[model samples]
Target: MADAASLPRPRRPVEMSGTNQSKRRTSRSWFSRPWASRPRTGGSWHAVAWIAVAACCLPLAGCKTWKKMTTSEKTLAEERTYGATADQRIDELAANAKKAKASSHADQVEFTQGLVKAMLDEHDPRVRCVILETAAEFETAAATAICKGALEDPDERVRMAGCTAWRKRGGAEAVELLAVRYRADPEIDVRLRALRELGDLGDREAVPVLATALEDSDPAVQYRAVGALKKVSGRDLGDDVNKWREWAADPDGSTAEWTIAEGFRQLF
Candidate 1:
């Protein structure tokens, strides 16, 4: 009491007991525990798991939303929505050509023909083929013109379809168009189809072209020309190119004999 500074400061509040010290350590550990080391309740962890799952799925949902639509899908969507533009209408018709029939409404036919005419020069070959096919059903002057133009299509399948449609809508003009395609088309199958259609047309103007096809490098072409010649001219030269050439040289000479022979053969 005489020297207060040296009195040991009243034993520093009696220095905590061992049991109290353990209690103090436990209380501090509760407050200072790492967040990851803490135990979680079922409801809290379930909500956190769902949040993580939603976060992972968000990007996938965004990817689906950002994907570009396909051409057929776009066309179908346009079909379901009304007030389509002229180009869109044309695309719809072309895309649905397989399911569509020749429209019985004259006004509809005329309108579609006008649209098809406008799309004739489109870069897509599929569009051109569908247009030509639909046009053929109308039997209109514009259809004939479009079919004629299709004979020169860069695609062989389009050329074949055009030729078939032209033959179905036959006239002098159609026969003439087929004759040109038969003689000038670089594709052998197209030439053969043209020749066959010409024979089906039963036009005499195709004889000279058929005779030329007799000497084609492709034996199939040569044989097809033989069959077409037989149908058109009633001559059965039996695949002999030389004999066909001889007959072609003077086609007018043996008409009477050939016609009589054809009549007799038909009788049998």
Candidate 2:
């Protein structure tokens, strides 16, 4: 062998061609990119340090408790918490209501609390409409507030939903609420919803409102009022508007004149 000083070092590897050259260029470009091996200058390293710290912290950031096994605990704690968007919140409330249907009474109360919280926090009219329906799931005072408050809600859609909610929860109170909504609500569709619900309720107490609706300028309102008056009064004197108007004009006096099945009830 030649002397060590006289021996030529092996030449650097020859430049590659075609696919190998392309791959090498790509690899070099990637590794030599701006963020790769970035020089520590001024706040640049501070940013990198924060980025590294963030990367290390990301998995653990959800845990403010810092207690072990609390990730699952925190998840359980937010079971009733509404989601960020209106659609997500609606889905969450719907799921909670479905769960509450089979859950124990206490669990249902908890669901109602979440529901009321969502309702109070919600600003979207569409979400408020959903809240009116969800609130019908429980009879809690908070839930009732959500349902009843919807009748007075600024959104017409929510007020309409409130009418439907009370219709499902039929009673003297439901009749009273529907009657009041029919009279007091300004939106024609909402008023129509109230009138329709009152008709379904079939309570005699709704007669006054239904009769008043008969005179409304909106022909739709007058038509609904006639149908509601028929159901509520338990009289089927045909769909003649004039006859119904006369009876509305003097309900007690016209009762005997328009008597049909009601007379049978009295006879029995």
Candidate 3:
């Protein structure tokens, strides 16, 4: 019944205002705060971030790997990678022994003895001498074996090394054996070496054998015997000096002969 002009306007839903839109945007940002924590803005930035993390942790991983390697693993790796020859291996072992820190002296002695035994058994005389030189470090039965074998070595240098080994481990039996050989050994050098070893042993029982050696055809043997007898029995062969001088001056004397004669003079 109302007039057309007076008719009521149609109602619509409430529209969002500018202030409401702003509030909605702020609320959305707050709700997604974690997503906004992106890395620096650059290409490959994500890859660099991951790499940085790995780099920081790589040393720790490497340390763990090193810890996992055992002593045996290290030894095998060295042998395989270093291409050690027989002599090289022996030298390596010797160097290792010197550097090793054993828990006890007995363990060190055992290790040294085993090393010497291995070298002496090597096919080469030079290697055997290397073992003989180190024999003083070992206090064991292996030294005894080295001495016995050295007595007959084809190489005089090797035999001399054996004499040194015997000196380091001299005993009554050891001196007696050398004394017997000093008077009877066919090689003048062997005879001289035996006398020197006996002197190092300093056994009283060796005196008689040394005295008998004075009659040997080799002046060097005779010279060594006189000095050795003097040491074992403290007796001076005063007039026998002339005999030693005559032998030493003999043109027929060899390097071994002169060396042995001189050693006697030095000892006496």
Task: Please write out the lDDT profile of model 1 over residues 1-268, one tens digit for every residue.
Answer: 4787666554546678999997787668656887554435544787899999999999999768646777776667766785455576566776554344444556555655674555554666766677777778765556667777788788998899888987888888877788788878888888889888877876767778777887788888888877877777765666677777777667877632555466568879
RMSD of each: 8.4, 12.7, 14.9
Candidate scoring better on TM-score of 2 and 3 = 2
lDDT of 2 by residue, 1-268 (tens): 7799998899999877799987776678656767654444534868888999999887777554446546565565555574356766788878868889889988878888877777877889898888788778688877888888888888788889999999998889999988888888878888888999999988888887887887888889989998888887877766677778788777788453666766577779
TM-score of each: 0.61, 0.62, 0.50
Model 1: lDDT to the true structure: 0.73
What TM-score, to 2 decimals, does candidate 3 have? 0.50
After superposition, the stretches of candidate 3 with alpha carbons farther than 4 Å from their true spots are: 1-90, 99-113, 239-268
lDDT of 3 by residue, 11-126 (tens): 98788899998778667755675645532353267678999999999999988887899977766776798655567766766785675434376766676667655764677778
lDDT of each: 0.73, 0.80, 0.66
Regions more than 4 Å wrong, model 1:
9-52, 57-109, 115-118, 121-127, 255-268
Q: Report the CA-based lDDT of candidate 2 relative to the real structure.
A: 0.80
**Per model, how many backbone clashes are there?**
0, 0, 0
Highest TM-score against the true fold, candidate: 2
